[model samples]
Target: MSKKSYRNKIEIAKEKEKNKEELLKKIERLQKRINDLEKSLNKPQNIQDKTELYLKHPEEPVVTPTLKKTVVNEQILWEINNSQRATKGLFEIKGNYEKICSIIPNALIIADEKGKIIFWNKAAEKIFGYTSEEALNNDLLNILVPSEYHQFFKEGFNRFKDTGEGPIIEKPSEFIAKKKNGNNFPIEITLSAIEVDEKWYSVAIIRDISEHKRIEESLIQTHQKLEGMLNNAVNTLVKIIELRDSYTSGHQKRVSELAVAIARKMGLNEKKVKLIKIAALVHDIGKVGIPSEILNKPTKLTDLEFNLIQTHPQAGYNILKEVDFPWPVEEIILQHHERIDGSGYPRKLKDDEIMVEARIIAVADVVEAMSSHRPYRPGLGIKKALEEISQNRGILYDPKVVDICLQLFREKKFKF
Candidate 1:
């Protein structure tokens, strides 16, 4: 009860605590020494002996009782910290997934094996006119497909689920879909599948193609109309030349047919073949101005009259040059009389200098003119006409065109 007695009691309690701490330290030192002795003994033991020890004491911990192994609290703390960091990472990943679903314009949706909608995004609402909450757990086909194609779509989708083969998933398909208002329209659709927790889900990308199809049809119709108008114009131009000279009226006609034939046999293109026909029709159009006596004379003309006849080509060029034709009209009219070897013509042009169309007309003109009778002279016949060109192939005509013409006459027995 006295103050001195209380002080003595406090000192005795402190000394007892100090002695207890010393005893614990001595025990730890002895345990470490015992652990070192046991490890040295276990090193030389065979695996069979170690297995027997494990079997005999199955409940015992792997560490020895002698080893003073304190729990590594710092390592446990490190592992706990790592687990918390991993959990935080998983939460961030979940947030990113939600963000992506919101931003992607394409319908990032999932449907179960039965074609029931599971997850839908904002794009699905915009495109299909169904909100995410309304679409979930609803049968996708019944919601979007027209009544006529619903059964067909069911068969196709079920087939894909069973066999992993179907036309819809492998390639995009065109299908008619009905809107919420019951209006139907064409859509291009692509489908893909993904497995989530052992169940397959399908996602589709759809685009409306009604406008594209309309534009394509319009282009086709316009092209056909333009082609018809062009043909009518060409026919009218051919008729005009036929009305001019009775002697050469049908002269241009027969020559046009034969010229186009020869051009095709020579492998000329459609454009060049058309040019040859138009050029042949207008070859002697200049004769419209010449006196009828000069053009349709029943007898041979004087030297002066023949010289005036040569002027028809220059006159034809002047007439055709003023009016626009798609072809090089003036060049066609000018070069028709110009020979390949510079031998026969108003202006003596030669060889490749002459256009291919003009070269064809030259052969056609010579052949038809000589084959058919003229008012001034008797017919030379097709034989002599072919003979004339064959004999003077390189001399007065292009040799390649000349050869094809001869082969047609001789071997093929080609008729006018």
Candidate 2:
């Protein structure tokens, strides 16, 4: 019961240890197979099949053809290695592209080469007032394109199919489109193309631009109304000045005409010319504050009277400053009497300090005042008026403005 029993117990322990070692080897092999399977899942199955062939026959070279194109099936493989689901093969998992189209805010419509709608997104349904079921497999022209544009769209589509290009592809274009409710509205569309298995498919990104168009039209109408009101107000102000001084009833009107012509001759834009004309029409508005006796004195005025006359510009500025104008009307009135050398009245603004509209008006004012009949003096004629501006071109008047004024009278035969 001593040495023999001990030996038998040692043999039993050795057998158990050997069995454990074999089981450990089997577990290692199983882990290596799992790792290989994971690596194969990441690679293309066709490439993996070729790799296996090369590994099995090391002496023979495997000639695999290079793949120039790939066909992406919409179907997704959900259960690759699961035995229970393998019988179902690869099933579609509800394509990502279809989901994206359904969720986007803008309308998306996909069509075949014959203009037959294949896919209509949710946004398309909302925009065109048509359900996806109603639009699918239908002719796009009959459903969405307005009757007036059917022929044009058909011609363009034919051209696009032949050349794989069109005026609307990859570029946004606006067109009048019809909805399911039979309402026609403006729409902006961007088109793109994709080739699938040798068949060309067109995708259209659409947006309803009816609201934008309405907003643009409204702004234009408001702008026109505001312009009309401004013109009426300006005419009323000119009439007020005329009422105060009967002798200068037509003086402002004549100055405005000449100022506009001179501005055009100087290559000023229409907007600037309009501003200059308006300022010239009311340039002497401050004269309404002067006494009638002083304005129509018919003789040389005294020093105090002359000083009072110089204050008209400042008074005109004060009167207009409270009113809001797109152009600097108040500043133009204040600076119209200013000179290039800072020798004029009121603020005595110099050169660039004076508003350009004011500078243009100053030249027109001198020419008109000198040529027209004033109560204090006789009409001096156009020749003398031209000489006055030509003599003091750079000193009293803007040189460019003076040159343009002279050219207008001499070359263009400009008349008030």
Candidate 3:
């Protein structure tokens, strides 16, 4: 407002304008010197003369003795501002990178070391039903992770932030995640660690596995249906054969139960155990071809009638060989009567010549038949039955099968 102050303001503005002009002039002079130096180098005589007056241009800037070369000042200006240009380019690249993240099918989320979400892509929005705007700056724990697992994950996340270590980093694991609408579903998540400004950040790729789970469950149900049908067919066949002699069918059911327990106690896998069970269930299926009067004969039979009973194994094999089974059910039934030594009837299969399923069924069949009461004889006690297998462990039965059978009865308390 004072006259002297106003005049001083005008002088300051003039000084700045003059400085700007001088800077521009210096740039122009530098460019001209470069042009003249280039022209001098192009001359044919200038190369041959090797003159001390290398620069023909009189307007060339003076080189101070402290510096042997006169450097390009404009080049220095470009170098000084190079980072400014680079910052602009980097900004553009950041946008393109974000576009790529958005287009990926899996949800991409970047959360800071403190577990605060900094980035959420389009797929993240779709999967969690939360827009990027809503998810950004939110706590990753509260937004997506189930509340019940909050403490479990909070501890892990804190550990990750401090030491850049956790069980989940770089590992793909399945977990349950909650959506915005308060429904929970399965998700497969993979996490990666990145360091920025001496701080750890998590880059997570999340995928919805709801559809996969549905498909898996559907497959399991279909398998169960097929299994039920197979079981029903086996039961119907067993019932048909049992119609001739009730004692034989009841004996078969108890044998199958004991066989399954023995197989499992031996740590045989499910498929083999399953085959053993089915084979034991139908071990007497050949009796359907035998005359009912012979099967139901209450008194001790003659040697010829006993030979007729032994024919049931081969006959049962013949009966079932035409039917398709997942395993060697027919062969197993045929070999059930064969002993481990070269003594038993039919093919007289010796040790290792018989299938292991048959060997297991042989032990189980002996135990259950001896333990149950017969129509003509009192049931031998379980003590006597165990002693029978113990006496015949290596000679007539598989050693492993006999040991497991003994353990099942004595320790595991398995029963028919």
Candidate 4:
């Protein structure tokens, strides 16, 4: 009874193993049949049936035509692998070009070699009131160039077409271009030629530079107005300095008169003459900051007091340097006390460093100060004044500027 039962259990186990092997072989045959059906459906006529099957299911998986295109060549497969990067780069360039056109507030056009428009950004629509579709087929010259420039446009275009060269060599040329509303406006146009498929095309970047030109002109006018105001302010400041020190009243004016005469004799230009005149008027402006007691001291200045008096020129530079006067008032004040051989106070600039304007003013300052009475000393007459400069030509005065002063006093008979 036990042997029979063991034999029955063994037969059942063997039957189960045989049934499992039969099921595995059936699954393998089914996979092969599916693969063969896919190949058969890829044929031209069977494709319609496969599409109908997909349509019936709607969500059934199927390969796309794009997948076939991606495998067209090894180069294409590599390009497909990098397609996301390529697409992102293209979108960035498009966005940049759009942003540029948006900011410019003018029409921009890119044309092929056949004069067919290819690119028309947003500002082109805003300015010319034309859509990208309308702009694409239009001839650029016909759209923007006025009737008068037709012959000129033809000549230039033909020249570029024939020789791939022309006279429009600069970055841009300022010209008038007509708008869609038939109004004329100024434009600055820059053009560069590009080639694709062995054909020449142009990528011209156009901007309305009229506003920039207007701004530049306004700045020039403002600068001129500011210069005039500074001159008036300086003159007023000097008058106030003179009013308090009545004895030195008319001192600067007389020096300026003599300085002008000497400068004319020296054959200086109008600009130099003007600089000399302004320098003469403000040569003693530093004395304004000096204490009135020291300036009008009846007794002789002590060594420390005299050292304090010598700081006037540096004070004058500090004051005038920030005033925005067209004349170099800072240099004039700095160099007025500077001797020709570097032997004067506060930056003793010698030779060419001492501007000719300061040299002329220096001579005039001494002549005026010596010929007129000061708190420090009584007046030395014109004869003694002439001798002082003559004794120290080149050593103290610039010889050429000094000679002019001597000639003005002696030969020209110019007097205060």
Candidate 5:
């Protein structure tokens, strides 16, 4: 080739090399711009002014200098805002939890799976007489639990560590705990379990129930005394009724016994049964107004005499209506003679009109009156009394009460 032609080829090669160098520099500048964009996207932005402006005028456009009215990567901005909000929420939750643990009235204790105390609150310090600093790092069983219960606690803790469950978790348990002063007292503890970073923690809420126990015991004693006094008053009223009718000496007492048994057999609650018994004991109180001659007469009662006798229930009501009784004593006394089919006396009250206690007493009254020897007639046999009730099951008496009464006689062999 000629020397001039070779030099021309070299010039073409140099021009190509210079163009390639300029292209590389432009590419490097573009890469630097991309890096600047990424940095700007990642760096935390002051969103307070923008947020306030947007909230104040939601329909207006945000024109903040930091965001610069240019289109930017929205996903990165959203992630940044979300992360900040999540971090704020987590910190708020932590602060609230600490506040709650500090202010709760009951002693709060937190321990790891190994029973090492991790958190002890102010209430615990007050209750166990140990400062929070003193309780931390101490074994919970050794510090709070009595020596006798240490083995039991250990067993429960082991079981809880394996299964995250124990008999004491999620339930309130009462037991004795020793204070720092060596005095033992009753404590109620509720335990809960939590998992943090793949580790188990136990939280115990303890309440010293000494005052509550003392108050409960005192209330029980007061209730017992009141019950005894009420029972004495009932006995005195029963005696008063007995004195009025000497011939039927223990009739009221026997009726009361049968009524109580029937009430219990009918599944009536204790309060209802008690009311029925007391009302039955004084059911004949109205008979006190009846002339002793009519009550003791051995002959059949004349129409006028029977009519007068029928008024005894109302007379008894009149006497008891003014007296205050927790039970419906006055109403039961007036309605005992009432039949379910409106055939009974005084008001001829139908089924639902009669008080439940009165219906129970009516069945008991009939059974006792039939089985016992009345002044006017010989005593009917128990079989005959049962037969009478069985025959009149629902017509004149409550079928359920009658059935219970019959069962008492046949199945339970109940006797006066």
Candidate 6:
């Protein structure tokens, strides 16, 4: 084919693709309107303001209430079970359904379109402390639903009455429900819309979740207690390190404070920030093995003594490695001296090879060590400490950690 003819074919194909896209967009818009119309159909129509609502008990002998009953005598139940309008779907009501509802652990209630109770199972009686006789012919909202939830029922019941559809159908939701003595308790309720002889009915299967909630609260308290004990153990280790090196008594704690602040400013999740805090608090644990004379030595230390000091990171790692922490605590301690350019001590790890936790502690360690008074020299001051990290941002330390540290001190007004 000629070049001009091929170009024309390509242009035609492009136009066809554009038309297909526009058609799909129009279909999506039409689908949204159809969904809105279906929702509107859920509004109530032709529902009576007052009607007899019956409450039936299929398990035991009948005690008929004289309230001009509108309910599930055997004929209405037969209508529900055998109606041409009844479709087999979620929570389908069938023959012997009342026997099953009566035996099930959950409380079962079936209300007519007007929100009047018609069926109350044996479990419902036990949960709500209402007999079938007392509960029968009563408005479901007035009897069992709490006042706070009345608005939802009023809105929802109308939709179910009109179109046999509502948000509460086909799924479970949690709410507070009223019991017999006027006490409110948590409940997990699953509702469904059923149609019998062209009339929509609302069916609910509710479970009292008071015990589940109590167990959840108990577990939270137990977790908090365990957290307290873990913190106490970490503090004891901090004290051990401080007691051994008097010149750096609060060094580990100050580093931890700064490291945590930097981690938070960097937008790390709380779990990771917590791990950094714990590692920073005990980063120098290996120094505990070194002689105190060298650790607290006055004036500048000899080369041999300085070499011994570098071994502290590995020493801290060895001691901490034996612990079974959920985080990489020992690794962070080992790499705290590591630099992005592989200039750090102990292992000489570089860049991405080092853990982020170690990177954060390294910056905190340097700032605290230089700013605080040491047995060998007077304090270097915070300005000089900031300059040290700023000078070697990417070369000696992590760039991101450095930037956040700078922001924490400069912009966030973070304190050690």
Ranking by lDDT: 3, 5, 2, 6, 4, 1
Task: Tell me how far the alpha carbon of residue 346 in candidate 5 is from the true structure, in angstroms, after superposition.
Answer: 2.7
Better-scoring candidate (lDDT), 3 or 5: 3
Tens digits of per-residue lDDT for model 6, 1-416? 33365457546634533442233223223322333223323433222211111123321121111112223223332233222322331123333344445455678787887888988889899999999999989999998888988997788788778887778666668889999999999988877655544677666778787866675666668667767886887888888877887555589889999999989888899999999999998998898988999987887899999999999889988998887676889889999998989878877888999998989999999999999888888899988999999999999989899998888788857876
Candidate 5 ranges beyond 4 A from true positions: 1-97, 146-158, 172-175, 321-323
Looking at model 3, residue 331 earns an lDDT score of: 93
Off by over 4 Å in 4: 1-107, 111-119, 133-142, 145-159, 166-176, 195-200, 210-225, 241-280, 287-312, 318-328, 351-416
lDDT of 4 at 381: 85
**What digit string (tens of lDDT, one per residue) describes model 1 on residues 232-317?**
76566556655656667788888888888889899999988978877787788877777778877888898998988888888889
Q: List candidate 2 segments past 4 Å from native.
A: 1-94, 110-118, 136-143, 147-173, 190-203, 264-270
Cα-based RMSD of candidate 5: 25.6
lDDT of 5 by residue, 1-416 (tens): 33365457546634533442233223223322333334434545656643453355333121211222322222322323444553554454446556656656678787888899988889899999999888999999897889988899899999877666799876778999989887888998877665434466776778787865675666678767777887888787777766777655488888899999988877889999888988888888888878899999999999999999999889989988887676778899999999999999999999999998999999989898898899889999788888988999999999999999999888866997
- Superior candidate under lDDT, 2 versus 5: 5
The TM-score values for the models, in the order shown, are: 0.51, 0.69, 0.70, 0.49, 0.71, 0.66
> Which tens-of-lDDT digit does each residue in 251-315 have in candidate 4?
88888899888898888998888878887777777777778998899889999989988998988
Q: How close is candidate 1 to the true structure, as a TM-score?
A: 0.51
Please list the C-alpha lDDT of all candidates, in the order they appear.
0.68, 0.74, 0.76, 0.68, 0.75, 0.73
lDDT of model 1 at position 102:
62
Task: Tell me the TM-score of model 6.
Answer: 0.66
Residue 3 alpha-carbon offset, candidate 4, angstroms:
99
Per-model tally of clashing residue pairs: 0, 0, 0, 0, 0, 4
Superposed Cα RMSD, model 3: 21.4
Evaluate residue 78 in candidate 2 and report its C-alpha lDDT on the 0 to 100 scale: 23
